[model samples]
Target chain A: MRLARVIGTVVATRKEESLIGFKLLVIEEMDPREERPTNNRLVAVDTLGAGEGDVVLWVQGGAARVISEEHRKAPLDVAIVGIIDAVDIADE
Target chain B: MRLARVIGTVVATRKEESLIGFKLLVIEEMDPREERPTNNRLVAVDTLGAGEGDVVLWVQGGAARVISEEHRKAPLDVAIVGIIDAVDIADE
Candidate 1:
């Protein structure tokens, strides 16, 4: 999974039948330092009630298919599965 | 799976019931180009015990749950499944 922040929402009227009920979010890649965001952006399937400005955890590829159980042909390369409130990084 | 190094670890106190004893790692997302680290990072479930600077392969979504078989409500989107010493991206 990667760290990303939901920047916007994607509206796709024509999509796969399996993806009809799933929400799509436009996420801007983020730095692990929790600094500024990056230029790259990705569209991900959201199932955890994430919204714009929320830091989220997203999965990609076959792993995504296993989570949402939808969007067989929805053309998504990423999926948001969780909303992260805090991270403790001192005990690595 | 993407290439990443274990930069640190995460410890959550009030986590979901299913994630009582799982280990989480702080990962830095690397550019596929292998250029200098992109300054991007992630927190992932570590089943392989990857150490700092070890490039690892991670699974997300249900694939992660199937691999770790824990964290039923732990809200993890990334799980480190294999430790990668090298990658031959030339074939991609």
Candidate 2:
């Protein structure tokens, strides 16, 4: 898992039926030392009760499907599993 | 694929052997309208030559595994496939 900030949300009115209840967020990749935002971003499903501006953890692929028992049958790539209150990196 | 901003880099002293030569970046999910920074973040592999502060697009799961031929054998869930020079959403 890597550190990132939620930049936006995605609303897919027409999508797989399984994704009806899940929320999708847009995320961007960042550098830790400088904390500068980069160009890499993705759409992830939110399982945790994370709102905009709340730092959270996201998982993908098989791991992502395992986040929620419901997702086991959903066709999802990214999923938010936890909200991060604080992060303590070992060092700069 | 989703939009994200790169926040930082990741250094894994020990990891899957197939991920040796790839560059990993930390990313945060974002919103397109308000563009506020949310809490959902993740680590993604960069295939494109994207740097800090550049918005990019990321793919995951089966799609991520297909980004690079090498990744077919690697254990990666997230990957940066392209740099987002611009994005035009339909409307607010």
Best-performing candidate as measured by DockQ: 1
lDDT at residue B55 of model 2 (Cα atoms): 79
**TM-score against native, each model:** 0.63, 0.52
Candidate 2 fraction of reference contacts recovered = 0.16
Worst 10 residues of 2 chain A by lDDT: A83-92
DockQ of each: 0.28, 0.09
- i-RMS for every candidate: 4.7, 7.5
- Model 2 local distance difference test score: 0.67
**Chain A accuracy of model 2 expressed as TM-score:** 0.84
Report how far residue A9 has shifted in candidate 2, in Å.
35
Model 1 spans > 4 angstroms off: A71-75, A90-92, B1-5, B10-22, B29-40, B49-92
**Model 1 lDDT per residue over A1-92, tens place:** 66688999879898777678888889997766654687879888876678889877666765565543354455666777556666544434
